[model samples]
Target: MAEENKQIAEQLIEAVGGLENIESVAHCATRLRIMVTDKEKIDQGKVEELDKVKGAFYNAGQFQVIFGTGTVNKIHTEIIGLGAPESSSSEQKKDAAQKGNKIQRLLRTFGDIFVPIIPVLVATGLFMGLRGLLTQEEILAIFGMTPADISENFLLYTQVLTDTAFAFLPALIAWSAFRVFGGSPVIGIVLGLMLVNPALPNAYAVGSGDADPLYILGFIPVIGYQGSVLPAFIAGFLGAKLEKWLRERIPEALDLILTPFLTLLIMITAALFVLGPIFSIVETGIMAAMNVVLELPFGLSGLIIGGLHQVIVITGVHHIFNLFEIQLLADDGFNPFNALITAGIAAQGGAALAVAVKTKSKKLKALAFPSSISAFLGITEPAIFGVNLRYIKPFVMGLAGGAAGGFFAALFNLQGNGMAVTVIPGMLLYIYDFLPFVLYILTNVIALSVAFVLTWMFGFNDKMLDEVNQ
Candidate 1:
């Protein structure tokens, strides 16, 4: 197996125009992310056809070859062993900035800032779902206890599990943004904490009219930035930039003390008095616009977003949705977008499964089956690029399936207790409510069935496979 992996690694290096052409290489979850000096020299078709390679695509100025999860780690190790330059984070970011267009780079930055924070949110979401399920009136009735019978301490414990992340979400975002933008993370955390300081009016309370905003200069309104994304992100960016600039100018002896002191003083004043109020309004407007779309008559919103979701994924800019979804969860405490997108994800898996079942070639079947499973498990790139997009029609069928399921999702007013997980594993999010859980399952079934049936009937055949193989 080691020798075979080494051979595949050698082939990959050669396929990408030899080791000299590779500027740096890295892997993330499922793909071998390579930065090459010359795109024209690399043979994309050969890269996709290499052993254990599911598919390959160029996005954000990187040639990413999907090898699935465990397989990718092995292949990456083999590549590095063969003397390809392993990318440092700084080198990768530099390459991304130089290679990608403005929109791609912006989206990548958002991804970098949010990806590390997702696991915390996912765990909190699961905690929320579990707590919701356990505390339902029906569940309580089974135990011959009412809501009043439950211990207040236990409920408080559940709240700790579910609410802490969101309550201090600004801190997490700022910390992540600081790291991404090259600032002292500890300083970022301090600055973020100042935004949500107990001294200020709570943001949610101020919005709900339960608490009035404190007046700065008797004109400007100020409030804590709990559960906020944009303001925190912007503040983190500005703070990081300011910190870097100050570090360059400040004397080495005073750098540690003076830089942070000046940064916090200037940024906190700017954040509370200027950036906070301005961006908070902007963020609210964006949230309101999203709500309007989600509330569109007859599930049209779902149909549009669901159908186009996977197409967006193909561009590698789908990370942009992280902001929208996170905002939905923070502002509304429920995420309808999660329900809408799951249908799109499920359809990809279904379409891939159809191709796997129908393909005659052993090689194609081998790629399609695991790719389908990977999609069902909440990652879709393998199924998408490896099988569905390669066929063209399967991808379209999947889109149709997504539209159908999304229609049902919106029509039924389906909402998830959290975000992040999707498809089969996403079942955890719906378990909080029995009816919603059933409807969520039904939505996925409709999506999977529509894509599978459509692909089986018209999207694929052995003839097309034979032609491609030839």
Candidate 2:
């Protein structure tokens, strides 16, 4: 075990370029993510060759090394120095002058929810989306021939897929929290599962509204921590402290059973009552802050949204932004106050499309173009992560183009006020359908065209296209 661990530790250190080479260490889902000075300095092939590595994939400015299982605790120890981010100004500056580790934190939470079950979600999402289409037209009923019980096969299967992801979210988070605290996440996962069970009210879909999900913990007013990313975050923070203490004091034989029990009691108690509410309120504040920013200025708003929209995608937290989009539309169908979105789609999508064409790396090109098309079709994730953000030049150019386009869109009062990106099909979805439609379509075309031209002009120097293609 020591030999294997030594090898794993060595591989990790090497992958990140000696222990000193690592600026920061973090993990999410299948990847042991790192922040480094230069990605070129690392040997990609060696990282891939490691027995535990699933693969390494780079996109949207982040490089990731995949580890299938037994990853959380191992990588967790490497970061946070087994417990605590340094309080010194230098350490904070190091963390700050860099990417703020927000990506790392967000990725960890997302991993808790969907990473473990991505294949299932996609397969099931496809099935459910198709089945919904089929059933709405009574296609499925034709085969079964029953009004009351037409065909739940699609619904059943889709629910199975969704339920697994949702129900397991807490447990997954627990594991992550454990790892974050410098302990075995498996036990944390066990306690998280306890909260996620169906028997627990306010466990699933309980975070949004006016109710506290936590009913009680044997009569204490513990809040619900189920289906929540932040709760686990708080729990993990405390759990780590508890784990370090137990590790020193407990005897080896009884430690395994006894330590976990104490961690559970203490962590759960703190998470359910004290920390849960605080995290919940903080999450609400973040959403409020982003919405406030959108109202600031067309140019600034566009720049912020355009630049970070892809970051939102890479972390899979774009859904949080999306909730705001929905609310904005609902509040004012014909509202001009909202930051113009159609232009954002066009600018980002255009930038992605441009990179798709310019890159000689056929694999990246293929992913980029089709993904851009998908973004055009209202799925910005693939385009933002796979294409635009990969090349800094294109991403920045697109943001500039997006800001210009969005400003023009706002000036024109071009409002696609109904559905978001996919509403491309129905221009009437815009309140002032004619002006906004013309402006949106025109700007999207122009910005994207310019984005493509810019990427070809600038990125080719760094792309190493000639060497790679040769």
Best by TM-score: 1
Counted clashes in each candidate structure: 0, 5
Cα lDDT of model 2 by residue, 1-470, tens digit: 54565566577567656656665556653455566666677877676555445346554334566553355345445444533222332233244334536675554344433333334323333343344444443554667654456456756765674345444655655675576446776777777776555555553244355555454555554455444655665666567678889879999999978888898888766776677767767855765686576656545565555444545555544544433443333233233322355456666677777776766665666566766666566555455544555455666666666566556554455554433333244243432323554666765565556656665677434345444334
Top candidate when judged by lDDT against the true structure: 1
- lDDT score at residue 301, model 1, on the 0-100 scale: 81
**lDDT (CA) for every model shown?**
0.91, 0.54
Let me know the TM-score candidate 1 reaches against the reference structure: 0.98
**Considering summed lDDT, which 10 consecutive residues are worst modelled in model 2?**
84-93
Candidate 2, after superposition: displacement of residue 311 in Å?
A: 8.1
| Backbone-clash count (model 1) | 0
* Least accurate 10 contiguous residues by lDDT in model 1: 87-96
For model 2, the superposed segments whose C-alpha errors exceed 4 Å read 1-128, 138-149, 152-154, 203-220, 291-304, 307-396, 400-470
Write the residue-wise lDDT of candidate 1 on 1-470 in tens digits. 99999999999999999999998999889988899888899899888888788889887668889999999899999999999999865568678788778877888899899988999988888998899899999999998988788899999999999988889989999999899899999999999999999899998998899999989899999999989999999999999999999999999999989999999999999999999999999998988898898999899988987788999999887888898888888876788999999999999999999999998888889999999999889899999999999989999999999999999999998999788899888999988889989999999999999999999999999888756666
TM-score of each: 0.98, 0.50
Alpha-carbon deviation at 191 in model 2, angstroms? 1.7
